[model samples]
Target: MATSPTPALPLPADRPLLGIAFMLAAGLLFTLLDTGVKWLTQSYSPVQIVWARYTGHMLVLGAYLLMLGWPRCRAIMTSVESLPGQFLRGLLLLGASTFAFLAFRELPLLQVYVINFSTPLLVTLLAIPLLKERVTLARGLAVATGFVGVIIAIGPVDWRAQPAALLPFGMAFCFSLYQLATRRFGRNDHPLASLFYAGLAGALASSIIVPFFWSPIAMGDIPLFLVVGTLGAASQLGLIMAMRCAPASLVSPFLYLQIVWATISGYLVFGDVPLIETYLGAVLIVGAGIYLATRRG
Candidate 1:
């Protein structure tokens, strides 16, 4: 009896794995963007760093618009007025970028990431009240778990304690607000248009404030500043593609893989060690985000 070698099992044809991989790659690049932004923060004002990032993103996005030909890019830029939800979303986006940059100046790269990553924790609760969804028992537990992580990350928040710890937390809240606003305008605008407007808003906002605290950017740091914007824009492009390929619930859980990239990059570049507490809190926050997004999905 010639037993035929067991037939090979077929790989799943679903693009879920591929989408996951794309998102993870985006996560890594985004972490790298953060690191570059944080490093530049050491030499320049936070406003300057933000200006570099926004300018880079605008330039990168503008290249895409140019590639689309003038007619299409004009169509996009002209059609922007129809998107109302972008106002608040733009405000929140500006806030997150501003605060996150300021926070980076004060905290280690990984620490800033740990805090900003908690936006979903705030979103889960905000979604219920704002979206008029039913808040189930499971979600309450997830939110509870998430805040506990926030407490852990904060350690004891005394007035005497470091103010830097609060920056990422504020960054998280502002970002959550931005996401909430996105849920409103997101239904109307094309993803590229929405992203373009975000870049425009950031550039406009930063342009005004950046002048106040401007230090002449040394020619040497120009590449890093440009890389921040380029990477940030590309990350958003990847997110749009990933979301289109798969539902967010499927993609959202993969976001936490950012922690791995951040930890590794932080160690290699900055020789930083994330405390066990930071890791623990990061897990809880990621767990909560997954629980809420999965439950709704």
Candidate 2:
């Protein structure tokens, strides 16, 4: 009797160094995208900015799909493991984007990034309930520490007096929920399909309301709009490549580099500088995030 043929081994083990590079690239691209959004917010509504972002994302993603040929494109289009979950994930990202745009309008980019860095801590807390994941006491303290950092960064301001200050927190919360949703429902879905649905949902939702908030696009700003979408798509693709090349644990910490990128970009483009509190608070938040990521990894 002929023996059964051996199954082919999966792709060679991940190249962690390369993954780190990809992660860094993704982070930089993301910072650029945010910079563009902040710049556009000077003249556009958040709704309009968000619509341009998602629309550009769809346009770029469509070109990518076409390059992969019709068969692969067809597969990506048909493969939806969970439509509702995908839709929810899309809306969460859209909400996060909206909040980020709003926050950028009201706060400096570095401050916005510092507040958003609390996302990992929020994700840990969210996981206990939504993902039914266990958390040790040490992790709990880290989460608390991260929050303390957020409070410090925000300073002792009355909430009702500065409602706009809350935008980044909303951004962090929505992003954390999006992360949890990806953990729950994305495992079995096609990567490209998931990417497609995310942009599709955002594009559709934003398109419906964008008309009401519309402003005529200046010819000079056309390139900026395209750049926003291109950067968004490129950054996402970089993230996907990073995950494929290395375990999340190996590359996750590199995400903190975004703080550096944001700080530098904020200074160069917008002439914003971080306060002493922002630095101190960033240390705590970044430290806590690194600790949690390493432990989980």
Candidate 3:
């Protein structure tokens, strides 16, 4: 049986709850992929892991498109001439992934994830200047609350603060830019086609880095690397389907699930249990995100 063709998306109203659930699921998969990348660092270089992820993501996505008669992939290549912002978004996304992969090597998985969740806060802050988006009082307060949670997640910044922890923060900031650019440029390009190119961009960028920073891949690490790629594709496709079903505001909050997913994965895989402050911070960030999402104007 053929899957029902997705109904055209209307603005901010249709099936909001369902879309949010889909986004939540996507976030869960994404963080699982993140955890796998984190684990691989014990035996593989971050660049190698990143390359593997791209390799897997491309193969999976390519296979999907091939199944669909190579719809979006063809369009992405033919239409690249007209899509500068998507290219820029891809470049920033690649940078963000690089930073994130490096951070995974340096920091605990839970800390890295919670810190990246601070992207929404950075998005709020950047909108005033980059997108000229008007800021509301609720969102301002929420951004503040979110940052407080981030600091809590980071623990006290001491002399022993790992220099590598900054990479995730940088990833958050750059990924926030990628989000903004997605909105700015997605007007002309289909989202999936744009994403295909973005994945290609990531793969190409890693080609250079994987040389100097490359390590020999162990057979043990291949499965996790495959998971990272396959799950990343699934998560992106899920997210795209979700946006078509419901408004972004409804689904956006679920991105925070990365923190939850990371927390659970860390506990099970690495014996890293959450501290009291971590839970407290999660509550504050979630509450603030809820407020910000629900606020009107």
Candidate 4:
């Protein structure tokens, strides 16, 4: 006997608890993935880590689509015009991940996460120009408040003293571009198709440079590579499941939990504790984000 196809997504009201669980799982998986990336820097090149991440993501997604059968596979192929957009989105994501990885090499996990949280603010701002979105006064205030939090997190004007401090900000900018592209494509393609393009594009981008940075993986480190790759795909799937189960507003706030996870992990793994200013800024950033995610238009 053949297995029945998967059921349609349940309404958010029907499964709020499950949605919250999925979001929590996604956050934990993502934080663990980042921790693994930071750990692997001790031995592997950033290029190699990035390559493994995208390659594994693509492979896992492909296998999933295959299991879902032909219609889903066709959905992922998308249209010819969308190809360039997908490729650009992939490049932006690659840049975002690569820069964050580089920042992790120098910065503590808490600091990197604090800066990375600014992507929502940047995304709202970028949408005005790129997506022709109208910014409500409330949204604008939230965005402004978020930037203030970012400044506090960044500390003094002399932050250029630690140039690497800027990498996570750069990562946030690139990630916003990637999200914009995803928004553009959302109008025309399936989410899985867009995800397929992201994984494909990211893998291709890193594959170009991975050759130069390649090292034979020690037997001991193979599991690390596998963990990073699996977590990348699993975390993405978890986020998708979360949104499928509940409204984005409900699921998104859970993402802020990453800061707590990052803080704890950073202290335990790296013996790095964040400054009081970092905590203050994080509260503001998270508060602003919660407002943005839940506020009426």
Runs off by more than 4 Å, candidate 3? 1-13, 70-82, 159-161
Candidate 3 lDDT by residue in tens digits, 1-297: 000111223445588887877777778777778778888887778788888877777899888778766555576556643466667877887878888888888777877766766776787788799988898887788899888987776676663556786887888888888777766765445556765877887888888788988766678767777888888677776776677768666676667667667777888988887778777776776676666665765
Tens digit per residue, CA lDDT, model 2, 122-149: 8899889888989999999999998899
**Of candidates 4 and 2, the better by lDDT:** 2
What TM-score does candidate 3 get on C-alpha atoms?
0.88
Residue clash pairs of candidate 1: none
TM-scores of all predicted structures: 0.89, 0.93, 0.88, 0.89
Could you tell me the TM-score of candidate 1? Answer: 0.89
- In candidate 2 the C-alpha lDDT for residue 282 amounts to 89
Error of 1 at 179 (Å): 0.6
RMSD of each: 8.5, 6.9, 4.6, 5.4
Candidate 4, residue 183: Cα displacement in angstroms equals: 1.5
Give residue 163's lDDT in candidate 4 (0 to 100): 85
Model 3 weakest 10-residue run by lDDT? 1-10
Give one digit per residue, the lDDT tens place, for model 1 in 13-44. 43677767767777877788888877888888
Candidate 4 global CA lDDT score: 0.79
12 in model 2: Cα distance from truth in Å? 5.5
lDDT of 4 by residue, 1-297 (tens): 000011123453658889889888988988899899999987888889999999989888888888988975775575434788778877988888899888888889888888888887888898998889899998999999988998898787456577888888888888888777766754345556666777888998888889999999999989889888888888877776676677777778888888889989999998997999898888888888788778766
Q: For this target, which candidate reaches the highest TM-score against the unseen true structure?
A: 2
Candidate 2 accuracy as lDDT:
0.82
